[model samples]
Target chain A: MSILEATRLVKRFGPVTAVNDVSLTVGEGEVVALLGPNGAGKSTTLHMVLGLITPDSGSIVLFGQELARHRVEVLSRINFAASYVDLPGALRVHEVLDAFARMYAVRRPRERVAELVELFELGPLAKRKVMTLSSGQRTRVQLAKALLNRPRLLVLDEPTANLDPDAGDRIRGLLSALARQDGSAMLITSHNMREVERMCDRICFMSHGLIVASGSAKELAGHYGAEDLEEVFLKVARG
Target chain B: MTAATPPSAPQALTLPPLSLAARRMRIMGVVRRDFAALRRSPMRMFEVLFWPTVELLLWGFVTLFLQTQRVPFVVTFLLGAVLLWQVLQKASNEISIAFLEDIWSRNLLNVQVCPLSSVEYLLGLVLFSLGKVAFAVAVMAGLAFALYGFGVTGLGVGLVPFVGLLLVLGWSLGLVGIAAVLRFGENAQVIAWSLVFVVQPLAGIFYPISVLPAPLRTVAWFLPASHVFEGMRTVMAGGAVPWDRMAWAAALNAVYLAATLALFAGALRYARRHGRLSRFGD
Candidate 1:
């Protein structure tokens, strides 16, 4: 079964439709990338799926249950991270992690926090307040928070946007590994096509509140008669 | 180190959804996090203490001078009004500012996305404010006793119902501030600090409601705090507990509280509908 199925979803803010009939799916253990330029409604669609916003029309089903009917139940098994949303800066890193662990009610919260702390390489930084951390460090902390629940469905928005190349590559590797884990599916939105190629099993290119094209890297390249997904994206985006 | 094996198509974790007990724990977790932040920052804690302390000291001296002038009901009229007003202001401001703290720190989006429902989040703020009020009230009351020889304990157990109604009124005002912040964002932050006092003139706290001009007295009669303050005057004037007035205050507070909560819910729905929730900090 798909972990997330958003069907015929539409959201409008006054005259501008943020997401228009955007239907998509992320199957069990699959990693899908939603690629779009700014204002393509990628973030808006993600917000609707997160139950942070209500779509004007259509439905979202996560884990075989309708979101409208069972949002809190569905949300308990899902986690989201974005650079735009942040943990409280006054809090120490481990304190923030521990607090979320308790909120998510993870089994063996202390052990889970310890494991994530080690996995995120946050040992030395754990005691410091989140405000003291650099941007790259904050991204790692957000990623750790997203993983705190061992969520079955993980949604990330521009997860590695501001990191240095090494940190970005490390995050891509970590996410790739997590996506490969059993019982988990991921949906990521990013502007970086190379990162999409490295991490996603399928790509949905969005523009002006619509999914204009969708395919794997090789398929998209061959379809567009291009060198790679980037060129395919350039063709689809500009056209 | 061994090479990593690819994950098989295994069964999903299928952890049971959060029970009521788990949800309560989540609320406590939020409260604990907020309390811990307040604990670490002595300045923020002092910010909560500073206003009430200053208000009490300022009025304590006034009441001391009034006693020499032999003002009528000096204990109940001036000291009582100031102390109770402090409780109302402290409770309302504490809860309203707690909501803003999440917004200023850009943490509201994260908290909202979790399994925490809007009601649960509101309850957490209320719980956190309860702690703040309890601590502040104790400190203020102690200082009133030491400085002016008047304290809440002087009212005996009659204090319970009075404090309860005042808190409900405060929560009502606090929720209105929360609704404003959600709808109008940071530009509306001033509402959190000043909304309650906008009704102060009509509340008839220091003076009796009869002292107001006819039209203003009509407005004052609608305020729950007016009834509570009048009840305080009644108690000081050798009357009974003023159960009828207390009942009126509680009833008015009930309607106000319900309306405030409804407005809060509607404001949240508006924020989500317009995509303002994420941009609230901006």
Candidate 2:
């Protein structure tokens, strides 16, 4: 497992410094949860790491190569999924997956799509346009697309943001299995405390565009002398 | 013991970097995805089939009343509309509007976070829309000939080439419209609409350019559509198509299209520089 490091990263939007001298490291086979209150610069950090936004200062390095210099090389193995981002509405579920699979250059897309269909239970709705699908179904499809290339590093803004409890549970289980078997590392953002407790190996607590605390879920919880991550989240978020 | 906990934990997880081939494939992926969207879209059917038919009937009535002594502008427009589908501006605008819809839906970041770059995304969209416009034009042309007997007096000889020229010209202007939308965003709707509206009255789609009122006549002469329509009428009317006039029109459209492409390229640079390329919805 190599290191993914953001060194002294700074970002400013006009008069505002969104990310203030923030730095963190994510390693292979590890899941990091970026927990923060609204407007805490979590998404901004993820955006900078992906090269979607450039920092005014500092740099992000993946596998020992600077991200800006090796963007194409670094990004090909990267995939992201979120409840908010969706495939084109005009595409059928099957077509959506097929297109992404082909885009990712999966050796045999039909086979890969079939595997996704089974994994996500998307077969029955394969013929339907994506816009017609419920949010949960769309989330599942997005996840299927994200996993199409067997990505190395995955970033999920809110993979299960709008799912029913049962569905969210299923997806969490699937993500757990994927992490255990494929050893894919992830950086996820969520407001769900229980999900963080169960899913993250390391939790980063962010406030005002800086990472104030990062450690194992239990460590942060115990370090703050809190009963659970939810209480720890409150203390950090209130700041 | 109830549970065995490991004391040592590997610090973090990582993935190997991607190769050149892998990177290219990811970009090509966006093109394929958009193509799939095109196939699934039903709006095109309405645009090519229903909209043209409706236009033919509705405008047919007006042309009949206005040009009782004349043949009818609807017939002329019918023929023109077949080719107008290939207008570079129209195809370009379609892709632009669709791009906005994606952003509004917040799905654009999903693709961007993957391997697809902004330029690659635009390329896929423009190419797909161009192909679609071509297909629709072909379809409408075939239907016009079958239903209305629009032979164009053996204009078929140079017809394909003429249509080809028009599409190339259209592609350049269409791309400019796309640039407008990407830059000005919602405010650019007026510019996009002008591409369609300006062509209608000035291009001589229905009536002869000579028939346009005195003040509007000068404006008509400045438009590429008038030249295209004049060329079409000359070929179909069995005239030599005034080769010199045709050349001038072609030259002018070429220059216009080139300028439009430049604008789009500039808009792209602006997006990249401003860090707005990756921005989703407003």
Candidate 3:
């Protein structure tokens, strides 16, 4: 079963169309990467699917329920993490995680928190205020929050951005394991082609608010007669 | 080989789905989280206490000086006006800042994604503001009593209706302030602190509406807070509770609250449509 299905999603800001007629799905345990240049509607489509922004025209179905009609119910089973959004600075990392756990109505919140703490290796930073954490530390905390609900559908925007190589590899490994072991589906956006190729099951290329190309990394490289996914991305994005 | 060192294992844990009371808990959680933020920030705590006390002292001494001129009921009138006005200012300021805190911290998107409804979030801010109102009341009322011999209890049981109407009025204005901040972004943040004063002259806090010019009185009459102050002055004049004025104030406040809520709803819709929700503080 698909964890998310978005159809004909269109969002226009003033004279600009941020997303236009985009359709996609993320199946259970699948990881989908949305690749595009800046302002190419990748984040807009993600925001619409997350129900953070209302599409000018479209429908979003998550867990087989319509998002606009059942946002609260649907959102509880979903989680989102973005580099652009930060937790309240004054809250200790544990407090931030606990608050999200409570907000999501997670079962056994303290235990869930403890589990995430171990999973993300968030031991030493849990007591410190979120503002004090290094970018990599905060990214780990954000990832921990995304897993707090054991979300059925996780939406991550640039999940490994700004992290050192070691931290980045750990995050990629963690997300891959979540999909394999927990049957979680994820929709991720990242400019890092290697991460995309490594972590995503399929890649969708978008340009000017439209999904111009989509396939597995190998399939896309073959489609463009390119040597690798990065070359293919450059070719598609340039066009 | 027999002692391959028995493997150690962690405890098995079970997690049940949340009960129906989860909704109530979620609402309270928003309030708890903001207060948690406040507790972590010493500067915020100092500002919360400092403003009302300073305003009280400044206005208290001003009332004291005015009384030396033998102005009729100057002590009661000015002190009562300043004290009560603080309710409107503090309550509105607290509520708006509470909402702004989320946006300023770049946490709006995180909270919006949760199962918590906007109304639930709003209710949390209202409750938080009410708690702030309680704090301001204790500090300002104590200062008034000690410094100028002004007694808030002089309104007797009438204090309930007076405080309630003003609070609702302040909340209405606060909702408007928050909506503006959401609609206009961080640049509009000053509205949270200064919007109350824009209406202060019209509300006639320190003087009766009768003293205002004709055009201003007409404008003041339309403000629910004006009727609240009017009713308060009547009570201080040893008249009845001015239920008519109080009722007028309540009715007007209801309209204002409804309008502000509608405006907020519209603003949220606009923000979502424009993809502004996630871009706040950028």
Candidate 4:
């Protein structure tokens, strides 16, 4: 079953069309990657999906309900995280998670927060203010926040962008496990081709506000007559 | 690689509907986040308690000096005005500051993405402001009684309506400030702090509306705060509670509050359409 269905989404800012006629979907337990170069409208598309931006013309259905009509109800079942956004800097790690847990109406918030703290190895940093954490530690906290509700569909924008290699690899492994074990669908955007190849079930390449090609890693490489996904990305981005 | 076969249709996950109790919990969650910050930051705690005390002391002394000149106004009248004016200031300032804190911390987007509706989030801000206003008022009232022997309770039952009207007016102005920031971004943050002052003189915080020039008096007539302060003066002058003026203030507040709420909703729509919400802090 498709967890999200965004059809023919079009968003324009002034004279520039940021996302033009984009249609995308993510099925249950499937991890879909939206890969594009700068200004290719990936963020704009993700923003629309997250309900942070209103599309000029489009429709979004999440979990078999229209997002526009059932926004509050639908949104309660989904969550999002991004490297560019920060949690409250003054709040301690546990405080931030606990607050969000209550906001999401999670049952037994304290237990849920404790479980996430252990899952992310945040026990040592739980008492530290968010501003005091390193970039890698913050990333872990953010991911932990994203899972507070056990959202059926998770949207991530450069989830591992700020993490060190070891931390980044562990995050990828954990996210893949969540998709396979818990059947949580995800829509992610990343600039790292190898990370995309390892985690994403399918990749969609976008350029200049439009998706130019979409396939599995190997199929995209063959379709673009390139040796790998990185070369395919270069071909699509340059065109 | 070929496309993986799609999973067969599974049972849709059941999501609980948002009950009134649940919505209230979420609103309190917003308030809790703010209180947690205030508890951790000494400067924030000082801001809540210290500034109001200082303002009371400064104004209390000025009122005492004025009493020596045998002015027409009693010490209670002047000191009472100072105390009441702080309520209005705190109500408006705290609301705007609450919103701005989320923006500064880049947490606005995080909150917006959750199930909390815009109405819920706004109510949270208002409730949090009311809490802060209550604490500030208590502190100032106590200091006034101890240092100047002036009691806010001297206004009798009239104080209730007076403070209520001022609070509504403050909320209206605060919503306008929030709308301005939404439409114009952080550059318009000056509106949050300055808008209340713009209405301060017109509302006759320290003087009677009659003292204003003809043109300004006409403008002040429409302001609910002006009517509130005028009613307050009437009570302090040993007259009836001025129900007519209280009614006028309530009626005017209804209109202004409605208009500001609409303005805020429109500004939020504009932000969403333009994608400003995603890049608000940046």
TM-score of each: 0.95, 0.82, 0.94, 0.96
Tens-place lDDT per residue, model 2, B162-206, is: 665566655555566667766766477567555655567766765
How do the residues A165-193 of candidate 3 rate in per-residue lDDT, one tens digit apiece? Answer: 88898788878877786678899999889
* Candidate 1 C-alpha error for residue B95, in Å: 1.6
* Chain B TM-score (model 3 vs. true structure): 0.91
Write candidate 1's Cα lDDT for A59-85 as tens digits: 999999998788778888899999787
Error of 3 at A231 (Å): 1.1
Candidate DockQ values, in order, are: 0.51, 0.32, 0.44, 0.49
Model 1 in CAPRI terms: which quality? medium
Give model 4 RMSD, 1 decimal: 3.8
Worst 10 residues of 1 chain A by lDDT: A102-111
- Model 1 regions lying over 4 Å from their true place: B1-15
Provide the TM-score of chain B versus the true chain B for each model in turn: 0.92, 0.72, 0.91, 0.93
Clashes of each: 0, 13, 0, 0
lDDT of 1: 0.83
Candidate 3 residue pairs in backbone clash: none
User: What is the alpha-carbon lDDT of model 3 when measured against the actual structure?
Assistant: 0.83
- Model 2 has a DockQ score of 0.32
Worst 10 residues of 2 chain A by lDDT: A100-109
User: How should the candidates be ordered by DockQ, best one leading?
Assistant: 1, 4, 3, 2
In angstroms, the error of model 3 at B140 is 2.0
Model 1, B143-193: lDDT tens digits are: 877777776766655577888888889988999998998888778889988
The better-scoring model by TM-score among 3 and 4 is 4
Please report the candidate that would top DockQ against the real structure.
1
- Candidate 4 C-alpha error for residue B35, in Å: 0.7
Q: Which tens-of-lDDT digit does each residue in A58-155 have in candidate 4?
A: 89999999988898888888889899999988889999998888788765668778877877889999999999999889989999889877888899
